[model samples]
Target: MPPLLTGSLYDAYGSYALVPAPLPVVAATALVLTATGVRRAVSHRAPAVAPH
Candidate 1:
């Protein structure tokens, strides 16, 4: 597998390098974000109880 970004950009006067994140890091980040979103949604949908 290749990194998300590759190669460099060149312009009339200068060149810039492109760095890509490792696949594992990207996957981990996505998983965490998704879990957080799902958790928030579930909590919002759950009913709240009141104590006497």
Candidate 2:
């Protein structure tokens, strides 16, 4: 029983057809990974202000 199908709460998915069960988690994980990779690259690109 998925949450979107007539659960305790009313969701906008009522009008949509064939919603993916794993889509939300998959999308969130991808977003997190992308953000982390970008942050790491930007940090390495910063110039060193102090002598080694």
Candidate 3:
């Protein structure tokens, strides 16, 4: 038996109590943008092979 609450059960809001705030947002955004760019670059750089 546990106390029922709203949102996440693990208390995500409490995380800010330990984190520096902006650091987390910036890190997450950078990671997503990097992944998107890398995927696009790889797809565009592929070479087509022709039968000899």
Candidate 4:
């Protein structure tokens, strides 16, 4: 089983919703991926300069 499966299952039961069971995992993954992508893009945009 996948790691997120357990959390998603718990969420499903806790909320008593059957249709949106995977919502939490999907949202979390999207948020994490977006943040990572932004960080990488910003880091690559400019180079650091050394002090004289």
Best by lDDT: 4
Candidate 2 backbone clash number: 0
The residue-by-residue lDDT of candidate 1 on 1-52, one tens digit each, is 3422333223322433333334578889999999999999998895878798
Model 4 misplaced stretches (Cα beyond 4 Å): 1-17, 47-52
Ranking by lDDT: 4, 2, 3, 1
lDDT at 9 for candidate 1?
A: 27
TM-scores of the models, in the given order?
0.51, 0.49, 0.51, 0.54
**Which candidate, 2 or 4, would have the higher TM-score against the true structure?**
4
**Local accuracy by lDDT, each model:** 0.60, 0.68, 0.63, 0.74
Q: Compare the candidates by TM-score and give the number of the best one.
A: 4
- Tens-place lDDT per residue, model 3, 1-52, is 1233323333767543434435677789989999999999999986988899
- Superposed by TM-score, candidate 1 places the C-alpha of residue 31 at a distance from the truth, in angstroms, of 0.6
Instruction: Pick the winner on lDDT between candidates 1 and 2.
Output: 2
lDDT, candidate 2, at 25: 80
lDDT of 2 by residue, 3-31 (tens): 64534233555543445555788799989
RMSD of each predicted structure: 7.8, 7.0, 8.7, 7.2
Q: How many clashing pairs does model 3 include?
A: 0
- What lDDT does model 2 reach? 0.68
Q: What is the TM-score of candidate 3?
A: 0.51
Off by over 4 Å in 3: 1-19, 48-52
